[model samples]
Every structure is written in C-alpha cells, then in structure tokens.
Target chain A: MASKVVGVREFDSLIPLLRDRGYDVIGPTVDEGTIVLDHVATSADLPIGWTDHHDKGTYSLDKRADEAYFGYAVGPRTFKRWLYPPRQTILTIEHAETGLVFKPEPTADERYAFVGVRACEIAAMEIQDRVFAHDAFADPHYVERRARSLIVGVNCAVAGETCFCDSMGTGPECTAGYDLVITEVVSGERHEFIVESGTDEGETILTELDGRPTTPADRKEVRTIIEDTAASMTRTMPKDETYSLLTENLEHPIWDSIAERCLNCTNCTLVCPTCFCSTMEDMTDLDGRAVRKRRWDSCFNREFTFLHGHAVRFTTKSRYRQWMTHKLAYWYDQFGTSGCVGCGRCITWCPAKIDITEEIAHLAEQTREEVAT
Target chain B: MTTTVTRRPTVAVWKFASCDGCQLTILDCEDEFLSIVGAIDIAYFPEATRAERGGPYDLSIVEGSITTVHDAERIHDIRAKSKALITIGACATAGGIQALKNWADVDEFAKIVYAHPEYIRSLSTSTPISDHVTVDFELRGCPISKHQLIDVIDAFVHGRKPNTPTHTVCVECKLRGTTCVMVAHDTPCMGPITQAGCGALCPAFNRGCYGCFGPSESPNIEALREAWHEIGVDDPHLVQALRTFNAYAPEFKEASETYA
Candidate 1:
C-alpha cells in the first residue's frame, strides 16, 4: 500500500467519508479532564495540541506547545469496551404453558470506525481477538462486533512515563492490524499527518480524501518521530526470561511482598486492554421473564475462581500472582503472545500505584542473583 | 385434570443501629421494586409497609450493625426464624462508620454525644451481625447498590447462590472505563482494598475510594499501608482511611491499629 501526506486542516474530511461508508466514527475526545473514546462528528472533537502527563497512579492533561492531533497516550478506557461491552444480554427466557421459552438476543452489528487507536491498543485488540473469536468456541457476539469494526491506528508521538511498549515490542508505531495508520507531523508553523493504507478499505477511504503523494522527506520525518518515541520510553520489561522467571518463581518471596501492596482490587486486570474474563448473570422480571447476561469479571475477585463451594485462589498473594503470571507467562502458551501491551493503564489506575514493569524487573533481578550465586 | 398453587417466598427487612441508607436503597429501586414485590411476599418491612407478618420467614435481609444490647439479642431471634439471613451495607457486614467508637471508649462517646450519659445504651463496640449470629451471606457497601440487592433477593427466592461479586472497586472502575483518580491525580483511593458494589462511584468522580463497601476478600491492608506511605501518605491519614465506614472489619481494624 502507498503512503500519502494530508494537511492537518484536511484531516476533518475523513470523518464525513467514514460516515458515508456506513461507519459510526468513534475517536478520542476530552471528557471531564481525561480523553475518552466517543462519537466524533468533526476534526475539532479530537484532542488537538493536547498531551497528558502520566505516572504510576497519576495522570494530568496539558496543552501542547505545538498543534498536533492524537498527542496523548491511552486512557483508562480501551477499544474492548466498544467491541465487547461491559454488560450484554445473551439469552432471554419466558414462562410458557409447557415449561420455558428461550430466545437468543440478536447481536447489534453496528459498523464502527475506531479513530486514534494506538499501536499498543492494536496489539491488545489482536490478543482479545484470539481470546474471543479464535478460542475453542467462538463468541458469536464478539465475532459479529469484531467483523463489523474498522480500526484507524494512530502512531504515538509522545509516550507516557508508565509506557514500556518499546520493550514489549508492541508499540510507538502502528505496524499492522489496522485498516489505516496515521502519524502526525508538527514542524514550525505547519502541522500535518503522514497517512498509510494497511487494507483495501483504508486505500478506498484515502482515494476519497484530498491528500497529495508523500515525499521521501515526509516519510523520513514520520520514521524519525516514531524512532524518537521509542528512544524516549524509560520503562522496559524483562522480555527474554519473563515466562520462565514468573512460572519458576510461583512460590517466590517477591510474590508475598507485592501481594502486601496489592489490594487484590483487580484494578490492573480491569484497566488492562487485553484482560477478557467475563461472568454470566441470570436476571428475572416479576412476570417470570428471565434474561441471561454476561458482565466483565476479574480474577482478583474470589468469586471468579469459585469451584463447588470454595474459592481456589483464596489469598491476595495467589490472585495477584495469577494475574501477573497469566499476562506475562501463561499467556504465551495460550495465545502465542504476551498479554500486556505495556499501555500502563493498570499502573496509572491502581490505587497503590503498583507497576507491572517494576515487578517484572524485580523478578528478573532475583533471577540474576540466583544465576550469579 | 390437576390444579397447582404456588406461594411466594416471605421476606423480612430488619434494621439495627445505623442510618437507614441501606433501606432507602431498596426504595430507590422504584421500577424493579414493583417487580420484586410481585414475586415475593413483603412480610415485614418497617420502612416501606406497616402491615407486619410474623415469621418463620423464607429470607431475612438485615441492615445496620449491632450497637445496642437489645439489637445483639434481636439478631439471634431473627436468625433462628429466617431460612436465609443476608447482611446488607457496611453496618451489617463490617460495622459502619460508628465502628470508629471501637478505637475509643464508648462511655466517653456517650458522654460527648448524649446530654445525659445515663440515658444512653450502647455496646462498647458496634459489631457486624455475623459476629453475633451466622449470616448466610453478606453484601458489603456503605449503602449497598440496588442492583446487587435485587440479585440477592432474586437468588434467595430461586433457591440459588446470589451472583454478587467478591471483587474490588478496581474491577468496577475498569468495567466503567473510569479514569483512576489515585494513579492520575496522586489521590489515595481505597478501591483496591474496598469490596465491589458501589460501582466505583468515588473514583469515577475524580475522588479517592473511601472503602465504603469494606475490605475485599483477603485484602492485604499492611501492604496497602506501606504502599501509601511510600507515596507520601502519612501514618495518621492511612489510619483515618482505614478507620472510616468499615472500621470494625477485622482487616481494617488490624491495619488501623498498626498505624495508631
């Protein structure tokens, strides 16, 4: 696919084009103090020239010195909330003369064009795709939603303090899994975007837009910006021995130390873009009509691992260990990839400010000490 | 030809020594309350209806804490007559804000609050219902969310375990996609140690979670205190955080005492 350069002023044209192609364009918009994903009608809705300062258990939005769209990192919310909603009704039942009549709720196949998606988020979506659509039994609702959705990826110009995507090898640049990829360029007095088509749909959308062919200099500038982002990231994960490091140290003392600070709040899993655990609920009306719904569940919850009459992971230590290990180690065996995308929503949102990268690094240090001894 | 008659399960709502916030939550379920009433017999709900029915009740939903000697005895009788006794709100489950008295002298509290200390009657400590009698289940919250309350009623009525979550407020915040106040703003939120029920209300509004739902299952309070300390949260503030609504809960009580 060929790349094209579009002026920042002309970027608004893509909204109407996406809407014309029967897509409800959803993009990042500032809600309250943070940027949240919502329906975008114009280019003005995007958080232009705005950046956010984020740390472990901290985030603050600020105005940028230059005008650049998609300036911030990922927020507390993820694209999964759109594809697989927090609460969804699966089956409805009614009392009949014989017994009960069951009716499966029809899936709403709304075509969504997700704008301003980050590289780490794209990786997170792929992880979820494997979990829901490519699993042993595919979830029909998730499959329908995934099939109808169109991803418009945005390369990160500035990484948050908590971001470790470079080490995770998942981000700072949107490489694949997107229909269209965008990289914003902010030179003195001029702001533009270097856009690339990753799919036929993206190519068709590009043809509708008023954009010029990109020069070699323009492509080189985009490359430089992505390289700078990757270089600026301070956080990193122990990629090589992460699986064995975690699995082997199931009974490590570090687990106990981290467990003490872990509220077993399940905040990490909840904010995690790739965490896909869910639980079923049966609700009945006064008229004896019942609906079976599914809501997002977390492993940190004792009820999540309930078997027979007792909880399996009864302690906070066990639950925290389970979540971390599942994300960094066990996930490789299950999905052939690590669960974490290094977006760091968990670190930012955790009340205790527990950093996963720090935990992984600590474990790696322990491994080094053991090897040295 | 055969004729069949089915009787609705009898439910009784009881209160102890705390605010009627939990009972108000039941009334707040306006649309669903009608449906719930249609399915169950409201045998005794002093807050809603005056028509009282005697038990052996099929289900008893108890609110508030056992602060008075009389309340302490009354819960045992209620437990004996009810098939299933479910404690709702932090009061009935952990002891509520009044449990702050657990750290101080109850006699001194009576002297300060009451004009005539002789007229006042209260136990040394406000205790959860389970401390006195067996609780079939417990729904933790400052004032329990109505949706969860409905789940408990529906589940008990259907002879099944209620699907109320035993997770922390973090899970709810994640589900709602609310920004983390603690992480983003350096605000100390109790979402991690707190139980899930209030839908992560405080955090959603850019405030820290006060742990209104009490401690989650196996909460590591010592570690949380240490973490908070590292974040510059002083010992007094940490103690005050744990000594809030669910102060008498074993986990919070022990954690608070460490700081005290």
Candidate 2:
C-alpha cells in the first residue's frame, strides 16, 4: 500500500472520478447551518475551508484558516444513513384477484462511494457489519448496500471538544475498514492530501488521479496532523473499565441523577453511528394496500421495551441505564467489541447535554468508592 | 354490481369546546373524504352536513373538551350510545390550550375578556373527554394530522388498532434527518417531550417545536425543563411553554405546577 501525494487542485478531480466510476458519491456539504452528508458531484461540494465546533449539546460550523477539504470533525449524519436508513419498507402487501399478495420491497441498488468518512465512523461500520452482515440471518438490504458501497476514510486533522476516539483506541488515524484512506495536510500556502489504497479498487481510482510519489515531507506532515488531533482531544473515557463499571453498577444512584437530566429524546441513539435498533410498522391504506416498514428505534423510547401490554423500562433511569449499558457493556458480549466508537455524536447531539464520557467517569469513580469501603 | 342492503357502520362527529380545527382536519382529508364517506355512514357530522342522526353509533369521532356542565353530561351520553368513541386532537385528549384556564380563575379571565362575565355559563375547568367518559382511543395534537385521522377511521372500519405512534418528536426528526434545533442552534425546543404526530414539522423549518402534538408517552418534562434552563429558558418561560396546547396533560400539568 504505497501512499501517493495529491495536490490540492488534483484532489478536486476525486469526486468527479468517483462519479465517473458509476458511484453516487456522498460527502460533507454545508446544509441547515451545519456540515451534512449529501450528494457530491464534484470536489466543490465538499465542506472546503469549513470546520465544525463540537461540544456537549452544541455543534456550530466555522470558517477554517486554510482551504483544507477534510478539516471538520464528524457531522450529525454518518454513512449509516445510507447503509442502514432510518426508515425502510421491508415488505408491501396488495390485494390480488386470487388472494392477498406479499412482496419484498425493491431496493434502489445504487453504488455508493462515501467520501470524508472519519476513522471512528469506520469502526462503527465494522461494528454494524458484524450485526447486519455477518450474522446467520443477515439483513439483505444492509448486506446488499454495504457490499456495493466504497468507503473513503479521512484521518482526523482536528479533534472536536466531545471527541474521545483516542482514548477508545478507535482513532485520529485512519487504520482500516477503508478502500481508500486520506490525510489532508495544510501548511502555509500549501494544501495537499497523502492518500493510500487499502483495496485494488481504491488503487485503480488512485491511478486515475494526477498524483505523484509521496515525499518524506508529505508523510511527516500527515503524521504531525494526526498526532495533533489525538493530542487536542480534551474528553476521555476509561474505555477498558466502562464495560465492568457500567454492567456491575446496574442499579447505580448515578443513573437517577443522569435520568433527572436525560430527556429520553432518543437523540443520542439516533445520532449514534453504532446504535442499531429497529421496529416494524404496517401501514394500511383504504385501498387494500399495506406496506410494512422498518424504522430506527431507540432504547431511550418508553415503548421500545414494551411487552405484555406494558413497557418494561418505564422510568427514565431504567431507559438511560439500558442504553448506556448496552452500548458499553452488553455490546461487548454480543459483538466482541464496544458499540461506541467514541465519535461523540451522541454527546454533541444530545439536547440534554448528557455526555457518555462523563457518565463513564462517574461510574468508575463510584466503583472505586465501593471497592475502598 | 348487485345492490346489497348491508348497513355501513354509522359514524358520528361530536364537538365540545375546541376551535373546530380537529373536525376541520376531517374535511381537509379532501382526497380521502369521499372514500371515507362511502365506507361509513356519516350519521351526525354537523360541520360537514346538516343531517343529524342520533347514535347508537358504530364509531363516534369526538373533538374538543368538556368545558361546560352540559358538555360534560353530553359526553357520558355520547359514550353510552357509541360502540367506540375515539377522542381526537388536544382538546379531546389533553384539554387543549383552553385548559390554561384550569390553573387560573376562569371567572376572573371571563370578566376581563367579556363585557358581562355573568352572562357566561361555563365550568371552572376545561377537561378532556377521557375525564368524563371512557374514550376508546385518543389522537393527540392541537389540530390532529389528517393522515392519522384517516388511519383512525380506516382502522375503526376495518376493526383494528390505529397506527399512530406515541413516541417523541425526536424520533420523527431523526427519521426525517432534521438537525436538532436545540442542539445545533441553541434554540429551546420541546421536541424531546412532544409527541410525533405532526411529523416533526417545526424542527424541519429550523424552528423549535412548540409541543403542538402534546406530551409524548411517558414524557420527561422535568428533564426537558432542566435542559431548557441551561439554554437560558427560566422556570417561568418553561412553565409557559408547558402550558401550551396540552396544558392539562398530566405530565405537562404536573411539570408546570412544579415550575409555577
């Protein structure tokens, strides 16, 4: 995997090249006063010279000092929006002359090339791949879309205030689960990308670009930028201790305090890249036509744990505990890896400003107290 | 087609103390109105037609709240007559905006608003239909979504439960990929505690949701209040916000009382 140096101007051709290669390229673009993952026809559609500031319950877009294409932290949207849509029609039923007919809904089958994908997001995708793709009863929709899609990983150059990827060992560096990985380097009066191919397809696309052999200076700049992003992260979760600390303290008093501020809004779960839960709904029209749709569900929802004509997790404390435990503890038992990639979308997007890293720290502190006693 | 004498399920629309917005939602179902009419017999819909038929109704779609003693008595009678009574909109489900009068002295407000307060013959409180009689189902919203209204009727006619979700507006916002106004713009939004029937309307336009669809199932109003407080919305403002459309809804009512 030899890395190549692509000049800022040459990088402009990347999106067009992906489009020409028959991909519906989705990249970051400014929308609704924030960077959003949307259709990218050319490199111009990228959130160039723009970055986002992320903190608990806050995200604001700001102008960057340099014209760096991949300068921003992860936005509200992730690649999950495409691979695992919030709502999807799984089956459609219509009345036929002979009898009622049930048919599987047709999927779009578009080849997707997602650009500007962060390293933590790549980790989330791998976690989802285990859930939706590797399982015995694999979801055809997710499997098909995932197989057809290509990921272009972007190593973080700037860490958000809520980010704790370095602590989680997910990354500020693009390590794996990518077809092509890139690191945008911006020096005074110069902007370029050091790119490497993780797959043959990525190499083919890289060959099409006007790139030169990477120099030592380019590699050194990429390393420095990644290291800086890792260093800048102010938030940290005791990642290894989260599982035991959360699972053991099932009835922690801290949960009640957290619940006091937890809105049960489902924003955290909805914005999370790895949180995957869905519920099916059958919609019927007057005309004998019924469609069953699978929409995203969250543990924070009261009805999410409904059983025997009543919700099991009736309190905010229970719901919040369920979500946090499942994300940090139960997820390890189920998927062999932590559900949280530490991308921090959950913290940033939470309307109540509930921080996962902070909660985990509280749990660790409480556990330490119990052990001392 | 052979003419069959099979009687359709008799449908009736009843009103109490609302703005007729929920009933108007029925007429707003322009494309489906005729089909709905064809499926069920509109025995008593004074808003749409002059024809008035007494129930023994198969389905009674009730709108508004029991604002007066007469309306309160009338709801019990309507409930007894109808096989299934479906309460529609905020007025029928959670007492609507007029329920703000529940907290204040109605007579005092009437004296200020009316020339002769003595002329007004109303109850002290505006209460939802459920407060008086057993309501089979309730479709909550200031003005109920037309699509959901149709679903209620369709489900009633077909003998099934309606598909209206009782989740928070945040679920709908996420489903539609609308950015959180409170999180992204520092706007005070009630979407976290508000129900999803309006399809997350306000937040889509970059405006905070005003809880027009009423408090969601098991809504955490206290949590929302604390969140809003952090964003500069004080207790008074939070109380005022909760006292909107679904003022008398137990969750909002209790939360507002705490703040008040």
Candidate 3:
C-alpha cells in the first residue's frame, strides 16, 4: 500500500493523536518579535504567514502567506535546551543537625516528541548524542532524555542570510537521524506535509495516521519541493577545500577588521547550541553553608583564556580570531566532526554585526589576487 | 553513591590566574560528575567546598596562569600537596587568555580588563605551570574538553599518560573529511598552529580556527604566516594571533616577535 497524506483539515486531529502516543509537540510561532519554539497545540499556533529576511546581525519580518507555518529553517534555540538545560541542578547539598550529606538531583522527567525540528537541528542532535551519550563516561540525563524522544524533521523552505549549511554538507533537507521527515509544500491548494520515514518508530506512527497511501506522484512532489528549497539558497560556500586553506593561514591580518566592532560580549557562545564552554561559581549563604553552581561561559571573554592573571586574546582581534578558528577548525579535532553545523545563530545575533560569509569572501578574493602573483 | 569502594581517591581542583572556566568544565561533567565525586573524595576545591580537606591529594587539577609572585610560591605549595598535578585548559597550560599581558605594557594590560589598575596585583607576564614546576600532564583548550579531562584523570588513576594527540587540528579536520575553509574560502585560520582538542569547531561552522588549542608539535608557524600573508592576514592581526593563551610558549612567542 502507498503511504498516506493528511489534508489541512485533518492536521488538527493529528496533534492529540500524537500526544496520545506520548509526543510532546513543539514548534515555531512568533514570540517577542522573533520566531520561537513553544508548546504548540493547534496548527494555528505555527508561524504560518510570517517569514524573515536575516542578514549579518539584522532581521526584518514580513507577512507572506495567510497560513502560519511557511518559513522553515533554524532558530536561535535548539533541543540543546532539552538535552543540556541552561541551568540544571547537578547536585544538591543538605546539612542536617547530625552532619552533612551530598545528594545528586534527578535527571529530566519529561520526554518530548519534538515537532518541526529542522534538518540541521537533527544533525546537531546526533553530534550532541555522540558527545553526551557515549559509553566512555555516559551522561545518564542526556541518554534518558534523548532516548525516549521522537523527532519530526522538516526541510528548509527559507535559509538564513548568514547560513552556510550547503558548505558543511549537513542540511537544507532532512536526511537521517529523525523518526519522520516532513516537507511543507505551498504552491496552489497544496499546503500539505509530504512525509518520509527514517526509522521504525516513524513507520509505526505513519501506520496509525488515517491518510491515503503515498504514490509515485507524491514522491515526485516531495522531490520537487526539496529541490526548489535547496535552489533558493542565497549563500554559497567557497570553491575549494575549507579546512586546509584556513589552517594554513593562522597569521592572517583580516581579524583586526572584524575586531574593530566586535564587543567580546560572548553572546555568540551563549546562543550557540554546540558551544560547550562553561565555568563554575560558589555561593555561601549568610550562615556560611556553601553551595556550588556551574554556568555557561564564552571564549570571547578575556577571562576565558586567562592564566596567571594574564589575558590571552587580550586584544579583541585575537579573541575574535580564537572564536572563529575554534568554531571552524579546532572543533574537528575534538569530536571528529565540525563543531559548527551552519546554524547561523552567531551571525544573526552578534552585536558586532560581523558576517562570517562576507569575511570569508574577502579572504577568498585576496587569495585569488595572490594566486595571480 | 557507590558504596562498593570505601577508600575513594582524594580529588582536589585548584586555580591560579584565570576566570575559573577550566575547573568549571570539570563541574560540567554534570551527570558523570556525581559518580566522579563518588569515585574521588574532593579534598580542596575552593570553588566548590568550604570543607577545606587537606592534601597529599590523590589528584590535583590546576586551572589558570602563574602571573603573580604569590602564585609562583603557591604552585610549589600545591605541588607539595598533590600526588598528580594535571593542568587543565589553555590558561593553566599556555598562560591563558590573560597571557596577552606578556607582550604589551603591564600597566596598559591592567587598565584593560579591570576598572582600577591599582586595585590588582599581578606580574608583568603570564607563564604556565610547567614553567615553574613539573606537570604530570597538560590538557589543552581555552576551555578544556570534558572527555579529555576524564581521560587524563582516568590515565592518572591507571598509572599512565593520557593519550592526547600532539598533532595539529588540521589532522583532525582531514580525518573528519571537512572541506578546508582556507583553500576553499581563502579564510585565514589557526588550525595549523593550534593543537587538536576542540574537535575543529570553527571550521565546521564554516569559519576558521583562531589557535584555541595552543601550538601543536613542531608547528610550521612561519610557513603558516607566509600562507596567511598570502591569504590577506595583516601584520597587526598576526601579532594578535601569537599573543593568545599559548602566546608566550617559546615557539609562538618567537614567531609573533619576528612578525612584530
């Protein structure tokens, strides 16, 4: 039998059914002047008619369609919030009249059936899975949260202005590591979901949905949708190998240009889903019962690379250089993967308005000129 | 939580001249942390406890730089107390981000990061722990990797050196099958100079490495500088690159001074 298709009318019914199967449906909607993920119930909660034009640290919103879920790509936040919470209570210490005992807090109690997860985010999930869920020193909380979750991946219809996913070879389309892949098609009367299944869990869910079986025409339509989305991408990667060229130019003078405006606030690290830099602090109550807490940190801070009361990357230029290099170069060594997934959160949100794409292009132009010499 | 072993090893975490991020990476061990703490009796973690457990510590993890006269004296005291001393992060091993003070006027550096320069007491240059005393092992990163930290600790407990690679991050990029950002995009990066540890993060993001891991084994820095110059890296930024966490490490220091 061919796979099924659920109409716009039938879509609302699917949410409760998904919840009945223990899926915690999360998706995008306009919040606080930006698109954000929240508890989406009705299909109306989706950011249907809204789309955004994002450039280096600049974004402008517009209303394109009457429907709520048209613009699909990466957002500032990710499932990192679920797997690795911002402020997790690692352990709790209680002092009894008798003595003192340390107690570990329990891991996440809720499992989410993530809805509308972008392809890049899915890849990000896989990368994070490797880091936090390994046998070497397994993170039980991450394992538990990631294990029971169901992901519904989406193909991108709109790419970020700063996005370079095509360069990393990771996304703009849903490929793997997700239960169900959905492509949103909106041409004439078609605002439908063209689904593909990557796992048995997705197949099982597909079996439960009451839509008609997918046909050859459906496959063709899905293919056309994804291809069109990929073609619409405005950003292009450079023509040559990225790592070697970058690794060969450690002393390049381009950093000073970007550093001129770079604030070194470390917001780039804060919004980055993969940036795992952090620091610890101690709090003592009035009674002097001390408790410890760890917080998210950024390499952009002068202290991040400080030693012996000295600051490495003291100049904003060096700090800028360090952050970019590690994001593009050194992360490969640590994880056997590129630390950045071309999410573009850093580019759009940076207070400095530095565009990685433009900076790289300038370098490429310079290299081209040098080659002629 | 594990009562199976009675005499757990005593673990102590120390800091010198840093913002305390490397030690925080240890705390970020989050879930495995309880078990690690269970495995070790945390002796003298000023950031975590007021217990003030004494030393002859089974293992001591040091973070930050040795920039002050007191810190020079303090490292020796720490060495006497620690059975194994492992320096964590770029700050501790490479003199950290603060090592920028090593190059410029000390008075200027003091004015840069702090509100009142007179309020602070520090040395003219930030130096690594290895400069002052012997370090059993050193882990790299502006903020050290958690898995690497565990590996170093595990190796110490098992009586061996941690198997961290000494090659450049470029090797890691090749292994990961990443498209070179510099050659393809002509983007200047530091993957060649920096050691492998951050998993080639920036390159994956379609950016370049800024030498977060410190200088690699036998860094061909001059060759890299020529490539950078050919690639449009300017002189001022070149000076900035060699002045990072591991800036004062003789090789990078020499390279930066040569360009300057």
Q: Highest lDDT, which number?
A: 2
Candidate 1 lDDT over B1-77, as tens digits, reads 11121688898999998799998898899989887886789999999999999999998999999999898899999
Q: Which stretches of candidate 1 lie over 4 Å from their true place?
A: B1-5, B112-115
Q: What TM-score does the first chain of candidate 2 have?
A: 0.97
Candidate 3, DockQ score (0 to 1):
0.02
Interface C-alpha root-mean-square deviation, candidates in order? 3.7, 3.1, 15.9
* Model 3 lDDT per residue over A1-373, tens place: 1246766666566567678887777777665455666677767887778886666555555787656464745555566766676555666555666566676667766768788887778777877776788668776777888998888888887787767776767777778888887777676666676666778888888777666667788878877766776666677655244455567666777776666565443446656677766555343321213354544556765555768767766666777777777767776776777777777767765534566767777777777788899
Query: What is the TM-score (0 to 1) of candidate 1?
Result: 0.93
Scored by CA lDDT, what does every candidate get? 0.85, 0.88, 0.71
Candidate maximizing DockQ: 2
Give the C-alpha miss distance for residue A354 in model 2, angstroms: 1.6
Going through the candidates in order, their DockQ values are: 0.51, 0.56, 0.02
lDDT of 1 by residue, A249-326 (tens): 999899888877777767777778999889998876555667899999988888888899889988878888999899
Local accuracy of candidate 3 as per-residue lDDT tens digits, B120-227: 887898889999999988898888887777667655544544657555665455334343455445677787667777877887777888888888754656656655
Q: Which 10-residue window of candidate 3 chain A scores lowest in summed lDDT?
A: A281-290
Model 2 C-alpha lDDT per residue in residues A1-373, reported as the tens digit of each score: 7678899889889998898889999999988888989888988888889999998898999999888898889888888999999888999887776677899987678899999999999999999999999968889999999999999999999898999999999998889889999998787977788899999899899998888898887788888988999999999988788887887889889998998888889999998999899988877766557789999999888788889889999998999898889999899999899999999999999888888898888778878888999
Q: Rank the candidates by TM-score, best first.
A: 2, 1, 3
Candidate 1 residue pairs in backbone clash? A57-B183, A58-B183, A58-B184, A59-B184, A260-B223
Per-residue lDDT value at B196 in model 1: 79
